[model samples]
Target: MKEIVIGENQAGQRFDKYLSKYLNEAPKSFLYKMLRKKNITLNGKKATGSEKLKEQDIVRLFLSEETIDKFSQVKVERSHGKLSILYEDKHIAAVNKPSGMLSQKASGSDVSLVEYLTGYLLESGQMKEEDFRCFHPGICNRLDRNTSGIVIAGKTLAGLQEMNEAFKLRSLKKEYLALVEGVVSSGAYLKGYLHKDEKCNKVVVEKEPFEGSVPIETEYRPLAGNQRVTLLNIHLVTGRSHQIRSHLASIGHPVIGDGKYGSKKSNQLFCDSYGVKSQLLHAYRLTMPELKGELNYLSHKVLTAPIPSDMKRVLEGEHIEESIHE
Candidate 1:
């Protein structure tokens, strides 16, 4: 017999959901059968698998030791890559993800920011291997593999739920900085409809709406620029895949080094001159919204990451000063 005591991370989820995590290898039908047979009981009573779990709730599994071991054998492989931490608190952490690092793993073998985060927590003793069975701490916002900057990570269940809600409501402010081809003397608020092509892994921005298109909002202002290129501060009003790159390209100002949505001539020039490779897009800043709970301490707070070396080198090479304050 195995007794599971619900913790903060394990609470507030449905009984069946918690069971699925606990006995991860067990089939859903088998779990429901156990519940019906009282082989799995909640607080010493037969459950319907729909009960809401609470902290201190007791779950009894009356299965053989071998059966329990077979089902609860999932493991987390911790990555050793170091994280550039921007801000951290008890409930949340914001990391400065370097360019070329994924916010999350793309395949089973790939390690990304999430693995780094798990490793950090385990090494620091903030979490243990056992905690992963119930709740896996992870990033709330995702950055493209080539984009660098502030990615928020939730350290606790409450933190995850609240931050996810904030982002869904667009209450949190996200900003980026990009160096684009040609000079942009003025800023503009761009509104368009974006349609993504899954096969090509690209997107198109149209001034008018079309089928399967979503409305996107992007705003940009020239922070510093020369005749050849402009460094713009982008406000991502409505976060969408490739919205900034495609929207700016539609306006004839594709981001430098963005081969997919940018000018080839400009990309090659920067690649040869400054050894540039990926797009020069950086998620520069994030601002938290007012909150009412554990994350209230982060209310109205602003977090920023400095421009990376490669991007900064390009700015210096072009004589464009980076005036954005960190």
Candidate 2:
């Protein structure tokens, strides 16, 4: 028999959820069966899967050492690199994820931001390899492969939980800087419905309601403009898949350098002039709400990533603020 003591980071989750992290090889049905037979007990008593866990809670596993080891076997691989850090604390970190990089692994061979993050932690001695066996750190938020910007990561369980809740509750405001064809003279909030084609990995934004569509909102204000293109700051009201690109395109303002959902002539001209590759959209700003508990340091903090040089060169004559103080 073995007993595990819960820590602050492990608190507030269900007992079954916590156990699954350790006994990963065990099936959920078998785990439930074990719970019924008192093979797994919480604080010396049988616990239903719904029981909320707390700090200092003791979980006793009646299984032997060999059985536990067989079930909890995990393989960890080491990688090394420097990942740009926007903010970091004991509980969480905000990383500047670059375009062309996967936020998470696309496949077994893909090197992702999470790998770099793990490398940083290992090199900095923030975590050890064995810690991954029980509590693996993860990115709480994600960005598209071509969308460069800030991705909030959780270095601990409490941090991940709270950050995910913030995103789910829409407490965090995600903002972007986009260059599009035509001049946008003023700012306005747009509301519509969106439908996505998972097979094609594309989405359509409609002004009127559509079946199987979810509501979407977007607001944009022109920061600067020339005769052909305009730079705008985009506020994502409802962050659906490619909402900004599709919504903007549907309204005749497709983002510059976007091969998909954009004008071919505009793309060809910009590519020739600026060597534009992907869309000229950068996730530059993030507004965090009032935070509590372990992540109080991030309360009301506005995080911004510097615009890429390519974007700067595209709008060389336009006056734009590098950062948002508020």
Candidate 3:
């Protein structure tokens, strides 16, 4: 028999969901069997799988301890890849994930940024895959597979819950720098409806209403501009699939090297001349509330990754002038 005490982070989640974390190796049949046998109790009363847990709830399990031991003994492998750890503490860690790395494991591949971090934790004696119930390490927000930028991961379940809430409430702010073809007007607000086409693996931007289309708003400021290209500071008011790229393309200013929504001829010219493979978009800044209130005002962190060589070459070649706003 084992007693599991719920914390503030685990509260409000379904009983079955919570149990699934602890009983990692237990099959679905075994879980339902235990539930049917009334082997799981909450605060000394029989609990149902649908029951919602509350903070400080005492959950008692009559299942054999050997089951949990077997699950814990299973070792998950470490993924071989490069991950730059930006910031880390007992509760969470921030990483600068490079382009081409999947944020999490895909349908078949076990190697991903998250798996790599998990392996790092295990090697550091901080956690194991089975112990994820108590110390739930996970990525809070997602970035596109081809987009590179800062990624925040929670080291504990509480941290995950808090960060999730932060993102949900829009308390977290993310800023990006993009290099696009043609000169974009300063202080431009692009609003449109974005619809995803799974068949083509692309997103379509429509100025008018379309079936099953979601509204997307992107605010951009032209930081610098020249005859050929411009540097844009982008703010996402409404996050949608390929919102920035699609909207910019709709306005005839697709991001450089964005083959899906850009000028292929321009991309080819730039790639052939400068040798940059991916689009020129970088998440440069992130601001969020910290766990401690002392650093509340200073919670904003700016991350500046070097511009891809291809984009740099183009920008340097052009004689663009930076504009200062009054």
What lDDT score belongs to each candidate, Candidate 1 first? Answer: 0.92, 0.85, 0.74
lDDT of 3 at 154: 79
**Candidate 2 accuracy as TM-score:** 0.85
> Per-residue error at 198 for model 3, in Å?
1.9
- Arranged by lDDT, best first: 1, 2, 3
The ten-residue window of minimal lDDT in model 2 covers 317-326
Every model's TM-score: 0.93, 0.85, 0.78
Q: Regarding TM-score, does 1 or 3 come out ahead?
A: 1
Colliding pairs, model 1: none
Model 3 C-alpha lDDT per residue in residues 151-180, reported as the tens digit of each score: 888777666777777767666677777889
> At residue 270, what lDDT does model 1 achieve?
92
lDDT of 2 by residue, 14-86 (tens): 8888778778898999789989999999999988878998889898999989989888967565568778898
Q: What is the C-alpha RMSD of each candidate to the true structure, in Å?
A: 2.0, 3.3, 4.3
2 against 3, candidate with superior lDDT: 2
Determine the C-alpha RMSD for candidate 3 after optimal superposition of all C-alphas: 4.3
lDDT at 192, model 2: 90
**Residue pairs whose backbone atoms clash in candidate 3:** none
Q: Which 10 residues in a row give candidate 3 its minimum summed lDDT? A: 289-298
Candidate 2 ranges beyond 4 A from true positions: 1-4, 14-17, 27-53, 57-66, 75-79, 317-326
For model 1, give the RMSD to the true fold.
2.0
